[model samples]
Target: MPHSERPSKRLAVVTGANAGLGFETARGLVYQNYRVVIAARSEHKGRAAVEALLKDCPEADVRFEALDLSRLASVRDFAAALRERETALDVLVNNAGIMALPQRELTEEGFERQLGVNYLGHFLLTSELLPLLTAAGAPRVVQLSSLAHRGGRIDFDDLQGEKGYDPWRAYRQSKLAMLLFSQALQQHSDAESWGLDSLAAHPGLARTALFEHGVRSRALVGALFRLTLPIMTQSAAEGARPILHAATASDFRPGDYFGPGGFAETRGAPERARMSATACDAALAERLWQVSCELTGAMWREETTT
Candidate 1:
């Protein structure tokens, strides 16, 4: 089905909308006439992003809300605030994430920074907002994943990176966990009849600021990224296309993965991409779900039980 024909009575919340792909995704949704709330950690950045959107799309109903995905308490606060203001939510873009930070850090909640922010925070936020999403008809949750997931593995023993931490490895594992969470969410939602569509998307190798956050050698990384970026990277706007398609496209299905259709799935138009074998492991997904509930204390509503 064409995007124009998709249902429009939807409210969308996109995390990390201050810049890069998140900003682009919000812009696309606003262009489609959706009431969008851009969630960011910094109030200044959030307000600036919303103002920028308004500059381009004067009719855009975009607003900024504070949300620090690394902290579970902040996630709860944001969710509670949203619940108080909105009766229903049609779309959630779990698009905010950190990548390749050189330092090994933990969130305020004490989980590995990458895992907490990239996966668990979204996990809790989504569960908390499930009721609002259920109130809307055919709501969708789009999780931003990464091609680096191909090299990821869930280290049950070192989920917090206690054993060791490599920035890239940690990021990859967190993204892998995100894919697993999206698949598990689809399964549970279907069995329990929640009527929510959970899909995952990757931006491929888009040249975004994700790598500049904590690199020890920013100049070298930036130079290398620029050198290879032409071959591997896509514009942030183009990188956001799959996410918009997954959230707004009619044919999107639960558990479906989307990404670039180009070389190494790096830089091209959006397409339904293949998930790694680990991402499709139901048993692992279920275990991860259970662990997530324990770690984040994110309880599912009765409606989410299979």
Candidate 2:
């Protein structure tokens, strides 16, 4: 429990905060004197997470907000509701995402589930909350990409994974999109004098429930994940460090990407991580930004101060 729930304690929003690295991220922020909102897809899980967090940080100011990123409508609803209650948003951790699903699925909005939830959803959320972020004076937005983004390419032609779906490719592309999005938004912020800092991070190989989805049908993989998880992957607490660092670091840089400093970025302390060249294509990022605005009807151009 915090000794003081100071009025004007910094506020943060952590998506997927109900579990895994997101849970650890939220916990660490609470320790750092943040009043956090745990955004989850399930109200039940969201409330439960707040209850559990209260056990450790009894004075931590935290609450649950239902956020189903898979659907644009849900994103809109969440944003509108958020605006009603809060005028300032200090930190936004876009931490919610799914890894490899054996079969491809689409959101009700009919976009590939991975790209929809991982990249597009956060895109809209960030844009919608841009005003509140600006009101906070200097806000940080952290987009959680992946080491997988190193090998990812955005197939703009098959954005929805309609031609043929490989779960890893879809997941990778979404992560790549995240990096590109972060970089592009930062560029816009600098050009427009938005005073918003946008950054990216990866957890490397953190042992989390996210793996359960990938290993469900493959007995061999499941066994490997179970047996080697502890040995190969870092704990969720370790994974959250990069995120918490990006959110609160004093020397933070816009468009900076952070991850593990160890071998292949698998596990260790935080550092400036690698990213794919494809993630740097300005033309591609502009196209993706436009596509995201069209898909979500977020209309971020209207938010420009200039």
TM-score of 2: 0.93
Clashes of each: 0, 1
Report RMSD (Å) for each prediction in the order shown: 4.5, 3.8
What TM-score fits each model? 0.93, 0.93
lDDT of each: 0.87, 0.88
User: Model 1 Cα displacement at 77 (Å)?
Assistant: 0.9
Worst 10 residues of 1 by lDDT: 1-10
